[model samples]
Target: MTLSVALGPDTQESTQTGTVTSTDVLTAPDIPWNLVIWNDPVNLMSYVAYVFRSYFGYSEAKANKLMLEVHKKGRSIVAHGSKEQVEQHAVAMHGYGLWATVEKATGGGDGSGSGKGKGKRG
Candidate 1:
């Protein structure tokens, strides 16, 4: 898919000590976010895998792996990028009739539930 983003010109304000304060630097757009796919009753497992393969261009093995993650763990972080990028991905996933959302990347857990027990099927 072709994506076009029009970025505005850079602007920086001078501080009292002759230091520059750029909003771009302060509000860094590079901060990462995650596209989370939630498991649900409506969609079939194979369909979820197909969406992953077709939309994200994931390999068959990778697509199945992520799909299973969603299946067993209740959710999975399928993709990560800047906030806007993941938000766009979430929108695309929604378009495909999948339950999806975006959240700031915490760099901690793998965005899965504890594997100690099986998850309830809806």
Candidate 2:
């Protein structure tokens, strides 16, 4: 599978081949986003871990680690994707009674925190 686009004049044509990934979306190029879940008193750690497992299909260990990060570090980035998708994830998190937000993913700048855990922006 391949995708090629010609963006009018003054721009070099781009070609994408093989395993087309989400980040390959030509709309925004290299700028991806993340879904950050904040720790809240109401949701139990067990429930938080459950959310990660059920919603994200994360392994028990990975989910527990992320849950621990939220509990100890105040927050954790649970997933990453485009603005629309991450925003939907945030909303779903809210529906599950967790605090979540979507922000532009930074490569170690703009104070968005480190990109770690099982983010889906690959």
Candidate 3:
């Protein structure tokens, strides 16, 4: 007696055969998420910089840069990491009386619809 077997065109045969795999695993992007701080009438500029330095241990120069970005641009991405870490940063900033949020770094669109012109100080 004889037996016959057939395999599909997409099937790959190991030495043992009978294994099936249709797709390859995909990897997520390596970019980190960002924790952003937004300028508000409530928090002083110096306080924002101080929070950056104290919470993230950022250097004075870097903290100042972020502060300036907040002041001029109405928002600045103060930290980058996983979603959990970014959320932690946002919470800490809120505790410090600063307005903060998190977002995927690659998506540059600010979810806040306040508009760029809205934040500009006269």
Q: Give one digit per residue, the lDDT tens place, for model 2 in 25-94.
A: 3455445576778777888999999998898777788789789878877777777655777898888999
Please identify model 1 stretches exceeding 4 Å from their true place: 1-27, 107-122
Each model's lDDT? 0.63, 0.63, 0.57
For candidate 1, what is the TM-score? 0.65
Give the per-residue lDDT digits (tens) of candidate 1, residues 1-122.
11111110110011122222232332445444667788898899999999988888777887897798788777877876567777899999999999999876543345332211122211
Which candidate's TM-score is highest?
A: 2
Ranking by lDDT: 2, 1, 3
Comparing 1 with 2 on lDDT, the higher-scoring candidate is 2
| Candidate with best lDDT | 2
As for candidate 1, its clashing pairs are none
List, residue by residue over 11-122, the lDDT tens digit for candidate 3. Answer: 1111121221221331243334567677778788888888877777777887887798778777766665557777887888778888888866543333432211222111
User: What does the lDDT read for residue 90 in candidate 1?
Assistant: 90
What ranges in model 2 sit over 4 Å off? 1-30, 107-122
TM-score for each candidate, following the candidate numbering: 0.65, 0.67, 0.63
Please estimate how well model 2 matches the true structure, expressed as its whole-model Cα lDDT: 0.63
